[model samples]
Target: MHMIQVVFMTVMVFFVIVTIHEWGHFYFAKRAGILVREFAIGFGPKLFSIKRGETRYTLRLVPAGGFVRMAGEDPELVEVQTGQTVAVRVKDGVVTRIYLDRLDERSNVVRGEVETIDIERKLKLALNADGVIESFDIHPQALMISKGKETQIAPLDRQFGSKTVGQRALAIVAGPVMNFILAFALFAAYFQMAGVPMENPDKLLIGDIVAGMPASKADIKVGDVIDSINGIKIGADSEKMIGIISKSVNVPLTFTVIRDGKPLTSKITPKKDPDTGVGKLGISAAIPSRPVSFGETFTYAGKAMKNMTILIFGGFKKILIGDFKMDDLGGPLRTAQVTSQIAEQGFTQLTSWVAVLSLYLGIFNLLPVPALDGSRLLFLGLEAVRGRPVDPNRESMVHFIGFAMLMLLMLAVTYNDILRLVRGEH
Candidate 1:
């Protein structure tokens, strides 16, 4: 049951984050008049799909990621050879529809053998009808039918490459921008619910107790003021209490707290952390906080997000300097495990986790690595500097290789996560 809950929450979180990211690209592409072929959630075989206008929205089997497919972003060949018979629906001497299947039942269909075709540029089609070679212009909104599937033929004006460099760059960067916006909104929501923490270094009040930890097992509750430990007069001195507890690993100590205007005593043994080799009570000191006005929440949330950004960038710097370990990297499995642990803490903590994940997604996508939005933006920058864009075939190959490497890295990280889980390590 626990595993099921973890999987469900992971999917829900990924769906919301990825859908919003893809919607960003979809919106800008439509604004730029670029033809978006599909806005799909997940990968692999489709579970459900519906076509609305030019874009087909699909839900697939995998819930890990999603994409927005823009026309002319990929190489698509409309293979219509000479001497191949096809049926067409004509309107005002222009071809409105072309059917490659032989089971066409529509009336007023013109059957002919293809003589010449140019769907991308001139949109002209020459057909050999009977003994006469007749040419007709294809409509800009023309549809092509093959094996019962219908798709609009994209012309040069509606292709991604045909747009201005500025428009293309905006369309590519919009996804990451949306992710940052989502993160900010989530952080604001969290602040509204939990309020901003106020510094109270001198006090020794319990703010929260970790579930199943020593403090929780000892029946320690939030709002309890620690009066002393092992009969020491440690009133209001949080640092002194911490020093005494850290040195008493695996040793039972008497803790006296002021609760409900009366003194209560409990015995707790601090657990030794394997990584830090230090005793931990798994309880946080209470920093007094008061509810803020409605407008103040946004101010605190912004500051919190800024701090998180700085911390994330610092971690990246450590990794670049070879000060970080590969084992510290977490993939999808590790993320799910951590998310499940946070979910047990209640909704406020879950929202905070979601916000952090959103920020990570936004910043990671902006890295100048091939197969990411940053790489596309880099290509656009180069195009602006030069007179023409880079060769499409070469760019595609680089992105493909980068994508393979990323997949390999994901697999390695997932293996580590599984190993850690099996060994009962966090």
Candidate 2:
């Protein structure tokens, strides 16, 4: 039962995070006047779809991938009717699509066979090497049965290629930007709901007493709020209290603690911790918690986001330098398993993990790998430098190769995940 909950929570997190990432592209693409034909969550055959404005929003069969299809992003392929072949001829910047099939004059439509029939749609067709149209798809509104007429799906300006480099860059960068924003917002909200820690300046509230430690030996117990240490008033500064204890290491000090509204004094010697080289209290104090102030909440959230980003980059650096084991890398399976475990802990734990995962994803997408936002931005950089775009064919090939490599890597990591699971290594 717990395992099932973990898996469900993990999958839900992925869905929400990926949706937000894709929404970033959709939002900016629309803002840049680019035609987004489809905005889909997941891949393969769609489970459900709805067309609104110019875009078809879809939920697909596979949760591993999602995409935003823009006009001119991929070469368009035209479907041929049964027993029909499509041929295109370009003359003086006009493209003509001729269907070799029988035509019925009475219906003014292509019907059964007639020697060599030409059902002509005369418009501009950009042909690729395969002789299929390089661009354009049939639009429902522009459906035409009339002979020698052209049908247009997208206008020239609405196409992705028609956008300026700056506009395109903005659209490409938006995905990563949105991911970071979501992480920061979630972190802020979590802090606001869970409350923030505020150290008590006037006293130290003992939260835990370590077994066989100096404080425990001295009869110090949990909830013994210390009002003073070594005759010095224990103020709001925890560091100062620690400093006093550190200086008095191996020496006896007087402690004034409040226990259930009663003041009690005791003498104990501070001992040095061999492992940490710090004065040992054998007792842990809990900071007081309070609701976050409006301004401070965001500050805490921003710091959390920043620290997580640094941690991700640091870990990546270590992995690159061989400081981390390759087997330690967790793919989707491990992510799901870990997410499930975190979910079992509580809502706060799961939410914090989501924020951390969001930051990780945002940073990962920004790595300059092909088929990623970072790589696209790199291509834009080349375009900016040369004052023109790179050949689309070459760009497409690079992305294809990159995507293939990524899929293979995911497979390998997934295999590792399964192996670990079988061994009960989670």
Candidate 3:
């Protein structure tokens, strides 16, 4: 049951985050008059679908990733060639529907062989009907029918590439921007609920004690102000006390604390952390906090967002400089595992975790790597600088190669995650 809950929550979280990211692109594309063909969640075989306006919304089998498909973005053209037979539904000399499949005979449906066609630019078609060549203008809202399914045709004006570079850049970058917005909102919500931490660097007061740790075993409690350790007058310096404790791992140290106007002494030994090799007393510094005002809540949330961004970038810098191991990286599997653990901690912790994940997603997408939003913006920047776009075929090939490499990297990290799980390592 616990595993099931974790799986469900993980799916829900992915759904919400991906939906928001794709919706950002979809919304801006529509506003820029680009025809958004589909707004799909997940990839692979479609499980559910519905058409609204010009866009088809779909849920696919895979939950790992999703995309907002814009017309003209795909390299392959869905076009009718010369000498192909097709059925058309015309209204007042305008072709409103073009069917690529055989349809039941009807007075409104005309059968013809295509002689010349331009559905994208000119929106016109010339066909030979019983040796008589006829030309007809296509309606702006013309539909293409294939396998009995209708999809509106996109003219040149409605294609993504037809838009200005500024519009295209905005549509591309909107996905990552929406992610940052979501992170900010989540952080604000969490701050409103839990209040921001107010820490004092001068005092060596014990605010919280971990269960079964050295301090707890030594009978030290929260609200106890530590006076000194090992005959050293700490003198309100928490860092000095921490230094003393960390250097004395597994070594007994005398701790004197003032509790309720009485000084008491206890001998505690710091335990070594397996991961960081740091000594731990399993106690946190005492900090006082209160609920923030409505305006202050946003201020605190903004600060939190800034701090998280810096931390994420710093971690990336360490990885780039070879200061961090590749095994430290986590993929989707590790994310699910961590999500399960945090969910068990309670709703507040889960909320904070989600906020952090959202922020990471936003920042990662903004990196200047191929097949990502940042790379698309880079191409647009070059286009603006050169006064012309790069060759579409070349650009498409670059993205395809980049995408393949990313998939391989994902598999590698996922394998590492599985190995860690098998070895009983978190």
Residue pairs with backbone overlap in model 2: 6-340, 126-134, 201-235, 201-236
Q: What TM-score, computed on C-alpha atoms, does each candidate reach?
A: 0.88, 0.67, 0.81
Error of 1 at 309 (Å): 1.7
Model 2 quality (TM-score) = 0.67
What lDDT is reached at residue 344 by model 1?
64
Instruction: Give the Å shift of residue 20 in candidate 3.
Output: 1.3
**lDDT of model 2 at residue 143?**
27
Q: lDDT values of the candidates?
A: 0.86, 0.74, 0.85
Please report, as a residue range, the 10-residue window in candidate 3 with the lowest summed lDDT: 196-205
Candidates by TM-score, descending order: 1, 3, 2
Candidate 1 lDDT over residue span 1-426, tens digit each: 266776677677888888889999999999999999999998779999999988999999866578899989886545778888988999999999998886357679888899998888999999898979989999988998887788789999999999999999999999999999999999999988887656554446787788768998886687788778899977566778889888989999898888888889999999998898778888877665567677887888788789999999998899889997777898888888888877766677888999998888889889888888888899899999997999999999988888789888888898999999999888
Question: Could you list the CA RMSD of all candidates, in the order they appear?
Answer: 3.0, 9.4, 5.1
Stretches off by above 4 angstroms in model 3 are 1-6, 103-108, 147-149, 198-288
For model 3, which pairs clash?
none
